[model samples]
Target: MIEAIEIPTAAGTFDALACGAPGGREVLLLHGFPQSALEWEFQLTALGGGGCHVVAPDQRGYSPGVRPEPVADYRIEELIGDVAAIADALGWQRFDLVGHDWGAYVGWAAAAAMPARIRTLTAVSLPHPAAFLRAMTEDEDQAQRSQYFTLLRKPRVAERVLLADSGAGLRKIFDWKIAEDRIDDYVRRLTEPEALTAALNWYRAMHLSGPTGPVSVPTLYVWSTEDTTVGSTAAMATERYVTGPYRFEMLEEVSHWIPEQAPEELTGHLMRHLLAHRT
Candidate 1:
């Protein structure tokens, strides 16, 4: 069963969804921009049923109480700290970490920053930061795909542009991948000015420093061919940054919304990775 809960840490209070028994294996899932712990509902169900304790929090900016105004508060280190803080609050001495989209960027950093505390890592729809940064500089396709960053980094402009037209632009980003019913709620939440601004602050504060190093935890990296946000250059280059056991799964026709759009396959990979790496 999934339970809505709140976790209080030194940083702030976070709204979260948790599943499985208190003593079950630990797993922490992180959602990316414009999304919340809600994105991991499917994963929580499957993994919790499989005897793993999973918790997905409305990360730093998404959780209203945790939202801070300064862009510096949204830096990559703060993001990584949030992950550890959440885990610490959960009483999880060690846990399997899974992340999607921008969440994956944080996962990579967490794995590198606190290698001993992470048993395994699963990153979806994004590659390692070093690989992605390199691809952005040398790969035209990736550079083109990332051009949208220029706009998202703007303080108030992105909030205006994305929330415009009743979130038509934002809703369109989901395309036909996310369930129609789920789209409205997700879009509506982001339509709130403070929420949208906090979400975009992630892009504005991104410096990718800690994530640029080698990740030493057992890791699984999932990439979808149709993911417009990430490119083949970075996906293929991700292996170079992992010093521990690594597995890369390429979903042939999947889009960037892997958890919602490809839950079964994603669950399968996650289960195998988790079961194999149980410490």
Candidate 2:
């Protein structure tokens, strides 16, 4: 069973969801933009059922008390620090990590910053930072796909565009594949005062920071063939950044919302990867 809880970090406290065996090895699941720990409901269930302790947090900007107004606060450094702090607060010297979308970016950052602390990493829907940057700079398809980032970087305009008509634009982004009630829940959480802005600050503060070097931890990267935002170039190039054991799974006809759309497949891959790397 998943339980709602508060996680204190040096930055602030975050609303989080936790599951699985109390004494099991730690697993940290991070969510992406416009999403909360709620997104990992299925993974929590599967991993928790499989005897791994899993915790998914609302992340910096999404959690009310932890939201920092300055865009600079949302920089990659602070974002990575938040993850480290979460680990420190949990008294976890090392943990397995998983992330989706922007969460995947943070996962990559964390693994790069301290590979020793992350026993395994499963990044869904995004490749490593250097690979993505190379794709964005040299691949026209990826560059075109990322144009939305430009709009999201605009502070007030993005707020108006996204929240317009009771979040019609934002709702459309999910393409109605997610249950209406679940989408409503996400919208409700984001529509809270200053919530949307805080979420968008992550995009506004985006910078690739060149190559993060190769990751040494056992890693798995799952990407969908239909992920419009991440093209073949970046997905295929991601393997170069991992010096340790690596696995790449591609889901045919799947969209970018892997955790929600392909929960079983994602869970299977995650379990296999984690179990294989277990010491």
State the TM-score for model 1: 0.98
Candidate 1 residue spans exceeding 4 A from truth: 208-211
**Model 1: how far is 106 from its true place, Å?**
0.4
Per-model TM-score versus the true fold: 0.98, 0.98
Worst lDDT run of 10 residues, candidate 2, spans 205-214
Across 4-88, the per-residue lDDT of candidate 2 in tens digits comes to 9899877999999999877787999999877789999999988888788899999998999799998889988888899999988
The lDDT, on a scale of 0 to 1, for candidate 1 is 0.90
The TM-score obtained by model 2 is: 0.98
